[model samples]
Target: MSTNVLPLSKPVPADSSLRLVPDVPDFVVGPGLSPEVADVVTLIGGSATAGRNLAETRRIFTQVRRALGPTVPDIASIREEVINTPAGKLNLRLYRPSFGFRPLPALLFFHGGGWTVGDLDSHDTLCRQLAIATGHVIVAVDYRLAPENPWPAPIEDGWEALRWLSNYAPLLAIDPLAIGVAGDSAGGNIAAVLALKARDEGGPALKGQVLIYPCTDLSASLPSHFAHADGYLLTRKQYLAYVANYLAGQDVEQDWRVSPLRAARFDGLPPTVIITAGFDPLLDEGRAYAGRLAAAGVPVIHRSYADMVHGFITMGGRLPAANRAIADIGRALASHDIYAFSDGGGI
Candidate 1:
């Protein structure tokens, strides 16, 4: 991770296939990425697994995130709760931006760390931001990680969390009718699967989904995955390592649960906002998922930060675009009918 900045150049052409919704005035798509993001990338460097094992990797991942991530914003309230699932106890943190008594729409959020790292604390700042930005109760789930709890465990926890949140909405001052799902990286993968599950299995109806540089395809065969595999923070090697750990020798890359983009149908899923970083390896799949959602008659908002890299959303401390992207997400959530709550004090 050299401090030397890459020479700036003309921005790459925007993907013609992606149809970005122009409703959000503040959420501008990229002609160029923030130079500050590039500086952060240099400061953070490649993967957390370069010379460390799973435990060390996990610790370092959280450490780096906290170091470079955004400052925690003040909120009206934040509370933690425990729920039992098939995999055992799961932890959820709820963030509220105001003390209003009105029942609010909620977003069930999962953190990104390739499913091997990240927890409530790792994503606390982002969740808080969403709470302020979207004017929704942000429920951040501490899903089980990989290697120790691979494949279905994380998604299993997510499903249970979604059901738990919806079933117990009133108690939490949340509107059961306005629930949605969101996550970044591996967590994004889970959110997408949960949206599909809510559609196929029925119950806990979802209003929308916001996937931030989500890993919609675990196969890692997409062209963007290769094109930006190295140099960027999320390298090809690190990504494959995370995939291997999550799979744990299981041959389920094609499974819809493992890879939402591999799902047979996308027609009935909720409205979606897919945010992709131009330099991220997962860029193509995120864009592909957005395209598929649009083609299937689902409302879709696809925005590509042409100059940003993978994991920029969490780097709000150093990246202005990161904060802007989050605000855009808030606008997207608010666009859904169920999310038409009071303006409150949201971003």
Candidate 2:
């Protein structure tokens, strides 16, 4: 809520564990794509086609993501529950890793769909994989989508879910002090906002955050937005449409919750890991956010997959980079000392 934007600084060096694929030449439409991803994109028409109404757009995206066949890890258990919130009941899917103790660290995950299309089922595979790789409890929040729920509604649901996890840690078999947030795209926006809210409200201290290709700046004028706006899984038109649907006539471009990069201060945030794909329209903002966080003295690790496109994380079944990225995320979480073990537990 501070109006004073944090001063920008020189780029932070990439984390040692961060991998950078070589950049492809400008002549290429989607440079450096793995064969699997390239084939998938080619089959689906590299960019989201324009002129579809909201319903049609949602249907197309849903079908396309379903076709990706995300990798499903063999977790110990999965359960469904709902968190009671002031606004309404929000659905949640809980995932337990195959090899972790009762009081394990937990991640409250939000899935990406431009905040319109994704659901618990859409991201089921990714959540399971994360639970297994990180050895942490994964709570996938099916937050309300935009144009219907819109703006503060999704944000509110995210906060409520995080609070519920922290408050009911014992019932959930999680360590309250070891919980964090993770999300991709629109979901990433929610996770970032939750981190800000927690810092301001002074409770539910988070261990860390993992934001994958997050839409950090809703204003959306970054260089990458123009440079890689087309021929990537997520296109410029789609990006604008998603924002318009999400904003629903309210003007909150300057609001920190909507645009965390515009926030006045970034201090006191948890340690963080931010991942950005080279061909993602959201790439520059994600990188800028990492720089801002580092400038404010928050411990930050930034990983850039220079050869990939946005939404690659959800294509792990085909993209080796996606699986590798998941593994890197696990290592980052563990290195932060967020995971916990009971007396008889083993890694």
Candidate 3:
């Protein structure tokens, strides 16, 4: 971390306003935020909900999410393909950072929209930036959404996508043993679940997992949930709404797949990077999950952006901190020995 702290300079857009709640703790206020992040928070106005129906809400959420950041340009190439899965044909966008003769490490990415919204396009720029920064082939999964496909459907899609990537490594020009899973928010939940599933299923061993402000608990009753719930970009109301739509009619609260923090065991999982925003409602749970992973002897790098709010990772173009966070994620991935040959041998 650098000693220099950049101060906010640009004037906030007239439509935006800082929506900090009264009586916030000094810790929550900590250091002043980057000007760009402050501007985004102002635009968000502390709530992301916009419509009465799921469709309208999704539309609004996607629009807001895209508007928060600028699109990154010039990746080596992007390829779109469909993979057959138990749920359906899953759409995937492959981002190649650079052309190379040897197989490269890869990350199977899931985009965040509370599992109710978000698509490959919504996260396209971020994925490309990450791919370029990390020198990894990034595969963005377009999993089915909620209030429709629901809980286990998305989970299954994520696991299936991971399996596909590992099984078809030669065709994709990726190292089967070097594949990892990553996502933000709901997508993070999916990535975490997929890691667990992979461990239990005993195949396609994951090299690592990068979870950005993941929702580890579906109960949504943590102290952080109530403390920083409203003013953060992701509010308690929006959290509840997404979960309601996702788990509607399902009673899998205690199921580890649905709420990973509730899992009885975290042993034998791959090395992990868990990132959490200081003011996110899901902060405590993410931290708790990291502790659990470490206790279970899994190598874990837990990072918390104490002065930032939820979804900061997606605001790289706007927030310098977000760019730094992305670099941190890249460095974490690079530090691991992902190039080690799998027992199955070279492709």
**Which candidate number has the best lDDT?**
1
State candidate 2's TM-score. 0.86
Tens digit of per-residue lDDT, candidate 2, span 98-146: 5434577788999998887788766777787788888878899989988
**What are the TM-scores, per candidate, against the unseen true structure?**
0.87, 0.86, 0.87
lDDT of 3 at 276: 92
lDDT of 1 by residue, 1-347 (tens): 11111121222122333211112222222223455654555455644544556676676666666655566677777787889887788988888777665787788999999888988777777888888988888899999988798988998899999999989988988888888899999989999999999999986788888899999889999999888876677888889989988999999999999999998989988888889999899999998999889899998888788888999887776677899999988777656444544532122
lDDT of 3 by residue, 166-185 (tens): 88877877877678899999
* C-alpha local distance difference test of each model: 0.79, 0.78, 0.78
lDDT of 1: 0.79
Residue 79 in model 2: shift from native, Å? 0.8
Cα error of candidate 2 at position 233, Å: 1.6
